[model samples]
Target chain A: MREVILNSYREAIRDRVLLVVLAFGVAMIFSSLIIGPLTLGEEIRLAKDIGLGSILFFGLLIILFIGNRVLYRELNEKTCYLILTRPITRFQFIAGKAIGLFLTILVTSLILGIIFISYISLLTGSLQITAFLAVIGVIFQLTMLVGIVILAATFLNPFLGSLFTIFVYIFGQMIPRAILLAKFYKHLAIARILSIFHYIFPDLTYLDFRELLIYNNPIPLERILFGFSYAICYSLVMVLVAGLIFERKDL
Target chain B: MLATFLFQRSIPPIYHHSEPLAFLPSGPMVEVTTAPLGPISPEIIWLAAIQYYGEEKISGGKFEFLTQVFDVLTRIDPLFDHAYQFGSIVIADEGRSPEQAIRILKRGLVKNPSSWIPPFYIGFVFYIHLRDFAKAGKYFELATRRSGAPEYVYRLAAFAYKKVRLRKGSILIWSKIYQNTDNQTLKEAALRNIRCLILEEYLEYLNKGLQRFEREKGRKPEHISELIPEYIDSIPTEPFGGAFKYDSSRDSFISTTYLQIEKIIAYLNNKLHVFKQKFGYYPERLDELVAKGVIDFIPPHPLGRIYNYRFGRVIR
Candidate 1:
């Protein structure tokens, strides 16, 4: 499992795709320093905004496109056949892949984060913890998203898997609001259906800490713990489901 | 985020959306603009707004896009207290959007209940620009109740009431400013406004009575007392513990202090006549008159005691 994790992480990093994403993220973050001064009195706020926004956006892009392909590459390259022949169970394989994906997103977000934080620290003359907190939330959110993608990949092709995963992530965040909106439009039937969907969906909004960071609102420890716990539990369940499905599949 | 941009609610093209925030920017414009970047959206928009404001003067003294600019900014970061306050000031003073400024500040007050400056600026918008004294007083009073409100806010509240002739309200505010302020200049100014308000109230009272007396008796009344139990119930007492005097020649009410000045002038005139009779040519100065023994002494004027006296003409 450790070798699987390291090889997968190294393989993903060696690709040109991640490099371009990192370059874009870096360029965007630095561009904010120039864009921020054009803004009137809120230069710092704008700069911080650009740094966090670019990191969140590009990091998520990596998860959506590159992240969905993690297990697919193993299956497509026919490496799963050799791995399955070994003593390792299907659960261990999926778990290793999940960890590898986690490592990949961690490295991606960290590079982008370092570049962003360095630029911002130079601007403010001090390190801002808000961006770090927001990045932490983004990392957890992407991890959970990757877990959902892995579960989808077990049942569908990589393209359909990624598409469905994006839908699930976005719609999950909107489920609670959709229920409220259904009620507001006075459709009791739709509202009830949406409430059912709300209970089943993994709310991505739970991990959205950008507003809290930008506004400098108090972030209680319990809230962070709850969000992190939610991501862990949800992703763990996805990995278990994916392992169950992959176990039944004929290589 | 891209999805938010694709199907983003478009701002209604119409300038008038006279609903809840009808005068406010359309909901579509605000939501779409601020939805992308989280809280940073407001900071960015606020900066953009500042640049927009600074780029050009309000053409023809009419500002446009004011509501959209601030609405988007505040909607992006509702806790941006300075943006709302500063936006309102800009809209009112520079943008010539007094109505929009009032609207924005009121919204700011709702979001930031603890902020005193919003209501203070709101009061000024109504008081200084709109000329809606009643609304001005209401907002000023609200401002004064909050923490960190300035000493002059209370004065403004009272002054607003004073303008619509709410004597009790004016007096209350004036008395508050007079007693509350430690600054001598501010206290003196407040006292002056109060005294002038009081004098105005007195003059108004006498004018009404005089008009009524003239209508009834078919002539201007010789004394304000003539109106007692007829046109007026009773005479009004001077606020300074002095009396009001009726100037028959001018057909106006004057302060009784003028009477003392008049008496001194009369005495001086008699001495000048005596001096002119004794001397073939009139003395150019009062001290010269004294030196020539025209009179025993120069009678001091009541208002300007021992003041300079010079004649442009020789008294025949």
Candidate 2:
């Protein structure tokens, strides 16, 4: 399991897609400084806005595109067959791949987040503490997304799995509103469907610290702890489901 | 074989299906809200600008387009505070109609009462643009009362009251700041400045009325009351409840008792102007004017109570 995890981490680091995603995130943050003058109020606001937005957008893109393709690539290359021929169980293989992808996402997000914060601070002359925490929230959301993508890739082709994961990410952010709309509809079918989605998808809205950043409000420590716990539980559920599916698949 | 088939059937449907789950519902269901409308297009924003400005080129079609744009933006994201901020400022300042801006801001505040930006703009329009200090003060007061209003709101409200000569109102507002703020130096400085300013304005009006009387009559009045019929609508009362003093020997009015440093400054400025006009140059010292019986005594600075009457050459 340890060897598989190490190999997967090395393979993800060498992936061209990960490098492109990281570069795109850095470029977007740089572009924010150019756009800063056009916005009203202080220049710091526009820079912080772009920096926080870029981190979330690029992190999700990496999780969706690269994460969805990672497991499928191993299967298509018959690497999974070679690995399963070894003494390792399929469950261990799936866990190692998921852990490796999660670690890649974690490191990539942290590097981009630090660059974004430093650049914004340089431009604005004040560090946005809320923006720093918001980037962490985005990273947590992306980690949960990685789990969902791994689960989807276990049964679906890479393209379909990626599309579905993207759909889940968008809808996950709108879950509270969706639930409210469902209540207004007074239809059990719609409510049940929305409820199932609420349970299955990570509540990405919980990770939204954009208001705190914009208003310069301090995020409560308790709320951060709750959000961290939710991400862990949600990611564990997704990985467990993915492991069960991979365990039954024929090599 | 039968047992294997049964076990496979009992397994979750996810394990049985090699294909990806296609759970997306089919058909164009009737959406109650519709796709949160699109962003207000740039053309619509241009049209709105034109319509609001009453440009000759903007037709009825363009006016309708602008309304649609505002409607779409508000509907799609009501919490977009910039739309309210920029939109209301354009309406009030450019459109020259505070009523229109108030309507737009009221709608926005109904949706988001907790937002401070809209109220700030509203108060700014009333105070700065319209010169409606009372209404401006009310809006600013309301803004400061809100949960998330900035510290600047309180400061601005105090300023707006001062603009319209509402000294008591301004003092009341600043007193709130003095009570609430932790900065002892700032609070003390602000209180002192407010007291000085209120007294200064009062003395200024009296001095101007007195000067106007002297200009029109070609001689100084026997009493300040004699000028009230022609030069002033009413006598200017001192801010801190003291009568302005007049000295017959020096032929000058003084406000030293009430600690009106600003009044004394204005008196010196007027004396300097009169001296330059008479002698074709300013006095070498304020005492030269005292010898000429133009002033009874030079008033001291209110803050430091220091005499400051040395006349310097006018730079201009």
Candidate 3:
């Protein structure tokens, strides 16, 4: 399991697409310095928002491009066939690949986060601890996304898998709004269906702390604790489900 | 190079431009489309709006889509206070649409209920752009009630209240500021406002009494005291450490400080008239009055202005 995780991590790190995404993320953060001062004294806030936004956007891109292909590449190249014949079980393979992709995303996002935090401190002449917490929120959101990608990769091709993951993420973020809309129109049946969907999917909005960074507000300790537990639990369920499907497949 | 230059010149010189907000979907459609991106959509739009405004300012072009851009931005990010504030300023000043600016600010106020800044900006738009002091006062007063409002909000409320002739309301706000502020300058300014408000009421009362005296007696009163029993109950004391005095020539009462200055001007003109009558021509300058022994001495202007003889008139 350890060797498979390391090998997958090394492959993802060596991907040229990862470097391009990271470069675009850094460019976006640097461009905020020019765009932020155009606002009426909201320079620091604009920078913080754009910085965190770049982290979330580029992290999602990494997941879509790399995490979406992590499994399909192994199967298409017959690498999984070679590995599955060894001592590693199918669940270990699935879990190890998910963890490796997640680590790549985590490291890439951390690099972007460090640059953003450093840039913000240079602009404000002081460290922003809230910026750090907001970056963590982005990481948690990407963790759930990587899980969804892995789950989709089990049955769908790379293109379809990416599309599915994107739809699920968008729908997951809109779960609260969907529930509210359902209740607003007084559609009890729709509300019940949305409630079930809400229970099944990860709510990406829960892990979005950009507002806290934008308004310089503090996140409560309980929310951080809840977000941590929810991301871990959701990712574990996704990986286990994908493992089950892969275990039963004839490939 | 020559071909490129000629081609560029051949192209018609662009005389007009609109902001890129024309590409935006309607509010609900935009919300549905950008729902995937969440807050990033609004942030991107806000940056675009700022750049458009800056370009308009540089080029001195009318903001054709300023209201539209801001409307779209605030619609997506309802709690974006800076967008409301800066957008309203550009719309009001550059777009020439104060009403639309106020509309955006009011929406911000509703969405950001806990924020005092939106209401403060609403008051500013009403006061500066619309010149509707009553509405300005109402918004400024609302702002003062919101948490985290600055002390200056009270001052603007008082000023706006005064413009609408709500003297009591104005004085009430000024008194609050005076009582609460620890800054010496602000405290002094509040005190001055209170004194001026009282002075305004007193002057209005005295002027009304004088008018009544003139109507009833068919002559202006020789003194303000004469109007006490007939017109006013009593003469009010001056607030600026000066007594009120009657100016029979103008048929009005003025504070002593102003009367002193008016007397100096009147004396200089009187001397000029006498010189014209005696010499059949006016002196070329005020100094000639003293040169020709028309008066014993020239009194200095009380307002630190040099009196000049201009075209047979004593002017300062």
Candidate 4:
């Protein structure tokens, strides 16, 4: 498991595509400073929102386009055939990929978050602690996203897997809001089906602290802890489900 | 290059008082476009709205794309409190649509039940611009109970009640403002309000006494002092130490003024505004006040003449 993790990290870190993603991500985050001047008095807010939004966007791009292909590349190159014959299990391979992708996302988010915070503090003469919390929140959300990507890749091609993960994210964020809409349904059967769908869906918005940063709204200490625990717990469950499904694959 | 691209797009086609057509396909349209990106869609829209706001101001007091962009932003993230604040100002102050601004703020208040700033701003639009003190008081009272609100929100609430002539609802808040503030200008402002409300209170007593005297005598009193002792106590002194009078011919209660001529004109102008709001235009003349039974005769000016009504203003 440890060797699988180290190998995955080394492989991703050496990829030229990862470097390209990181470059664009970092540049996009810094571009907020240029865009800040266009707003009336919401300069800090507008810039920080764009910066944080860029980090989230580029991070997802890496996971969907690059991260989802990690497994396919291994299989196509017969690296999985070579590695699977060793002591490592298929679950360990998928888990390693999830963690490695999460590490890459964290590194990219940190670089972007730091650039954003520095630019904002330079502009405003004050550093907002909420900005970092927002970054931390993006990292947690990306963790779950990485899980969804890796789990879906086990069952489908890289393109289909990325497409499926997109639905997963959209559905994940919309479930809480959709549940509120369920009451408007007149039929009990329809409401009951929607309730079942709502219960089974993952909610990604709890990890969305970006708005909290924009508004300077404080998230209580306990809720922050709950968010961390929720992300970790949710991601572990996804990994567990992936392992159970991938362990018996004929590959 | 980016600016040119947006201008070429010319935003999207929109209909007046219709479902908003966002230049960028806002709210649900934006949500669908950025769905795969997660909740960051609204933040992206917020940034775009900022850019749009910066660019569209070249037009003279007209924001063709203003409501479309802001409406979509608010709809995308109803929790976006600052958008509500800035949206209302842009609509009210710049777009010349105070009613539209109030509508936006009211929806924001409903969406953000715990927020005080929305109600505070709503109160201000009614009080300062619309001069609908009752409407202002309703929203300001809502703001008073919201957490994280400033002390001034409460003061405005109190001031609104008093401004609408509900003098009893205003006393406690005015007293609080008078006692708590150390800023001389604010203290003086609050003190003046308190004195005005106090005079209204005293006037309430005098009015009841006059009614009693009229009922007993079957005619108006001959002298100002006739209502005193039997119908009331000593005459309540004017808050600014002026005298009171009774006019038998006009059947009017008159209060003498030591107020500046400008203030007197301002006071009469405010009454005229109220009259216009009621009758849909300025009264044909000050004597119309007697015909409408609003007052028995014209209020006296400090210059020993009637207020010079010119072009809808009572000038010196």
Candidate 5:
């Protein structure tokens, strides 16, 4: 599993898309710095807001573009057979790949985050712990995203897998709201169906601490603990499900 | 290259003859749809709102959808303080909807109870635009209670109370500032305003008592304390430590503190005369001094009395 994870990481890092995404993300941060002064008096705020946004967006690009294709390409190219003949189980392979993808996202977000935080510090003449924590929040969100994409890639073609991943990502964020809406309009059947999805889907809003950054308020310890616990468990469940599907495939 | 340029030039520009923010979804829908983007979504929408406001200003059109655009933005990012702050101002001053401005600022207050800015802006709209000084004083007082509120908000709160002739409320806020501030200058300023407010309170109390006594007895009271048990509960202590006197010629109470009130009355009457000279008629309202740029704000009468505009003169 260690070897597979390292191999997956190396393969993902070598992809040109990673460089393009990182470049775009950095460019976005710079653009934010340029536009920051134009947002009236909210210079630091706009810079930090746009910087965190750029990290999340480019990170999502990497996930949807690379993550949904990596496992599917490996199976189609018979690379899994080469790995499966060794000591690695299908579960270990899928889990390793998901972990590697998460690491890629984590590193990518950190690189963007450092530039963001450094720029914000330069502008404000102080270190921004809120910006740093917001980056951590983005990393947690991407962790769940990586797992969902890996699970989708196991069952669907790459194109459909990416689409399915995006759908789940969007719907996952709206899970609480979907349930509320269903109940609001008095649709009992729809409410029941959405309630099932509520448990099945990870509520991504749990990982969003950016709004709390505005007040410079410290995010409570319980909330951070819950976000970490939920992200890891949800990703583990996704990898476990993908492993089940991948283990039964004839390929 | 010339053919391509010509083709581009010949292409008809897509003119938007539609209203701004017309296609914006409801706040709840925008909230759910933009939920995935987190705070980024509001920033984008806020940029769009700024552009829309600029275009509306340039085109001289009513900002028909200003409220809805900001509503969606704030709903998506409730902590988006700039959207609430800037948006409410544009909605009130340019969009001409002080009520909508208050609603948006109030929404911001719900999300950010610790922030003084939203309440301060709400107070400004009430005081400057709607001229509802009581509500203005209420919100300004709320703002002064918040953490990190500036000393100016205390002054604004006191000033707003005085605008509505609520001298007691004005005195309380000024007294609070006088007690809390470490700045010697501000302390002195607050102390001065408090004394003025207190003197105004006492004069009004005595005058109202004199009126009630005259109304019942059908004759003027010879002494200032004659109506104590019936008209006033007690003769309040004079603010200047001087005794009140009954002036039979004018049929009103008098004191050394009346000197300050007399000066203010003379100044306002002179402004009224100037307005009459310039415009050939007295302003129907005293705030016309502010509207005509002769004064930044209507000066509060020292006796907590509303100035009545009559026949080219201001009488308190």
Candidate 6:
């Protein structure tokens, strides 16, 4: 298990994809300072908006692109055979890789988060503490998405897994609003189905901090804790189910 | 996950029916036809009235219906920010009910404690339309204390307080802004406007004294200083580093000494007109006109307060 963890960490650190995503995220944050003035009364608002948006978007891109490529690259290069010959279990290997990539995302997210917050403070003469809490919330959301991608990859090729994960990410963000819309249609059957989707899907909207940042509203601590718990529980379930599926597969 | 899969499969496949009900006569039939067939559940009707109230084509009875609908919408979703904004603007600006707008905005604030937009609009309505500057200043102050209130709002509140004669309050607020702001143009503008306001108040007192003198005497006063015993506490000094002068010849007042040149020209023209009106020819000398009683007292030129007993004639 220790060897698997160390190897996964090294693989992610050596990966050039992480570097590209980090550069893009940083460049976008700096660009916000230039774009912010054009928005009239919302200068600092636009800065925080573009900065936070870039972090989430570039983080997701890195996760999907690198995460999908990791396992497939190992499989295509026949490195999985060498790893399997060792005493390490498949579950340990997958868990270590997921954790390693999660750490990479956490490091990158924090770097961008600090820079964005500093920029906002310099522009507005006040720091937004809520923005930090919001970044953590978004990280949890992405973690759940990473789990879903790993689970999908266990049962399908990397390409299909990445596509399915992206679809889930998009749908997950819309699930809450979708459920509300379904209720308005007066179709009990449709509402019931939507409710089921709501419960099963990891709601990314819970992590959204754009409104709070733009409007300077304080975030509720209870909601943040609840959302964190939801993400953790959902990701654990996906990973465990993926383990069960992988254990039964011939590969 | 299994529960969700089972629920999806449990509903009857009505969507797959060959003959769909197209022409539903009654509401119940429409409901039945539109009901979700498979595992999909029907959408819930959450505050349907809100949608109807937002329609722009509503008029007369429809407008009244919309108000009721909005009330229902607010009751259902008290934290709906957009509803409060639209409803408050409609009631205050269009309906001309500042009281109703205030009540609605207060209710919205209670539900959404973090919102600043409602408080900003509340101040705006009171300041601009109702002209209740005191209430407007209070609301604007509250908005500034909030997290998202813009910087310009603070300046506006200071101006409003000044309009309502809250001089100390206005000066205090503006002083704080002047200290914090780095924009030279904005700072200078604020300082200049405040000075002008202070000067205007003193000017008002002088004009009121002049008016009281005229009311008592039944004609315009000969000089502003003559009202000192009756209407004024003491004669006010000129504000812009100039002294007041009284002209006995033209029975007029002037502020600065340099205005005497224009005053002499005006006095000469007036005496010429009087001479022509009385004797049908221009007066040969200023004293000749005074001797003839064509002018009991030669009024001073309107510009200069110093008497200028000069003679002149009109060319044509």
Highest-scoring model, TM-score: 5
Model 1: colliding residue pairs: none
Worst 10 residues of 1 chain B by lDDT: B54-63
Ranking according to DockQ, highest score first = 5, 3, 1, 4, 2, 6
**Please, what are the lDDT tens digits per residue for candidate 2 over residues B112-196?**
6777766766776676456688788788988887787877688778778777455554455456545644334335534664665
Q: Write the per-residue lDDT of candidate 1 for residues B137-206, one digit (tens) a residue.
A: 8999999999878777777777887775465445555566577544343355457557756866887788
Clashing pairs for predicted structure model 3, backbone only: none
Worst 10 residues of 4 chain A by lDDT: A178-187
Which of 4 and 6 is ahead in DockQ? Answer: 4
Docking class of 3: incorrect
RMSD of each: 20.4, 20.8, 15.2, 12.5, 12.1, 21.4
State the weakest 10-residue window (summed lDDT) of model 1 chain A: A36-45
Give me candidate 5's TM-score against the actual structure. Answer: 0.70
Per-residue C-alpha lDDT of model 3 across residues B115-230, encoded as one tens digit per residue? 88788878877776677898888999999999888887887888898884566655665676577544343455467667867877887788888988889899877667788787
- TM-score: which is higher, 1 or 4? 4
Per-residue accuracy of model 5 over B227-289 as CA lDDT, tens digit each: 878888887777556566777877777676575667777887888788778888876556566
In model 6, the runs with Cα more than 4 Å from the true position are A124-129, A181-189, A209-216, B1-111, B114-116, B119-316
Model 1: CA > 4 A from native: A172-194, B1-25, B28-64, B90-97, B112-121, B133-316
TM-score head-to-head 4 vs 6, winner: 4
Candidate 1 docking category? Answer: incorrect
Question: Chain B, candidate 4: TM?
Answer: 0.44
Lowest lDDT block of 10, candidate 3 chain A: A36-45
If both were scored by TM-score, which would come out higher, candidate 2 or candidate 4?
4
DockQ for the candidates, in order: 0.13, 0.04, 0.17, 0.12, 0.24, 0.03
lDDT of 5: 0.78
- Model 1 lDDT per residue over A60-165, tens place: 6787677778878888999888987888888888888878878888988888887777777788898877878888887887788878877888888878887888
What pairs collide in candidate 5?
A: none
Model 5: per-residue Cα lDDT over A54-112, one tens digit each: 88889889999889878977888988889899988898999999988888888888999
Could you tell me the lDDT of residue B125 within candidate 4? 69
